[model samples]
Target: MKNLIYLLFVVFFSTSTLNAQDFSDIDKSPMDVTIIRNENHSPMARVIYSRPSKNDREIFGSLVPYGEIWRTGANEATEVTIYNDMTVMGQNIPSGTYTLYTIPNKTEWTIILNKKVHVWGTANNYDPDKDLMRIKAPARTAAAPIEEFSMAFQPITNGANLLMGWDNTYVEIPFKNVE
Candidate 1:
């Protein structure tokens, strides 16, 4: 009887633990992260943004629109943290957290780094005067279609490329370490 009780308890506990292991995303748009590491393997810069799936819809020049400011992600404004002082597109930005916004076009995209952080969707209250810097990057065609919006930090000689792509379009913003 004692052995039978122990066996039942083990089974019940194991089942409960298995149920607890289910991690399901409730939000249609899921948050994602991109981290740029230094030579020492420590994070030099990081970005937190949400990924919005295409879902058979037009992504650029239609859903995202052209020549308009976008929050650069889904739910909240995309957040970027710079661990150390860096130069982005020839403009110096001190080590700190900031909101990343973008104005996308068919030919090119303008990347904007703002001093404001913790902003919610679309940056309705975005102040142009608070902009740290704005840089233009030419758009490129992706080799394959990207169904979902994604961002990545591609390693480079001095720093990394902040690459954002969706629906066959690719945009890259370069960031280089200051010291």
Candidate 2:
């Protein structure tokens, strides 16, 4: 009985140590969410994405590459949630969660609002036909470089602007509020 108890303790200890080793201390690009609220402080729209730092490396036209479908963020695909039905870039997008994708170019970017959500990494599972809409947004150079990826919604007349900025470039997608 004593030998059996001792062996059980040893096995438990070994297993606990091994399980603890599975976790990592290193942090990957952190996840972030941007929410747009109305006058009543109600959330109108929100976006969830990972923020990847430049890390002294070239972003866009090189690291991310030009004219390729980017996940819009790092790690998992960037997701956007619309609380109410709205028009995005003249295309009606029903209120729902969606994956936001982008095809970047030197002068412009094709921003897509995809029906697919909660996907991982790039456009590996992308279906262009399922995209709710695709709109051309001009890429504008920022006055200064922004090292981390960021997306936010800015208030506008009867609508909002979805701004995406990273490195030295930025783009804006307009979304009109629906009653």
Best by lDDT: 1
lDDT for position 81 in model 2: 94
Candidate 1 lDDT tens digits, 41-66: 98889999999988999888998999
In the predicted model 2, the residue pairs found to clash are: none
Residue-level lDDT of model 2, residues 1-179, one tens digit each, is 99999999999999999888955655568999998887788878999999999989989899898988999989899999998888987788889999999999989999998997778976468878889888999999988999899898999987689999999999999888886
Badly placed stretches (over 4 Å) of model 1 are 1-25
Estimate the TM-score for candidate 2.
0.84
Scored by CA lDDT, what does every candidate get?
A: 0.92, 0.89
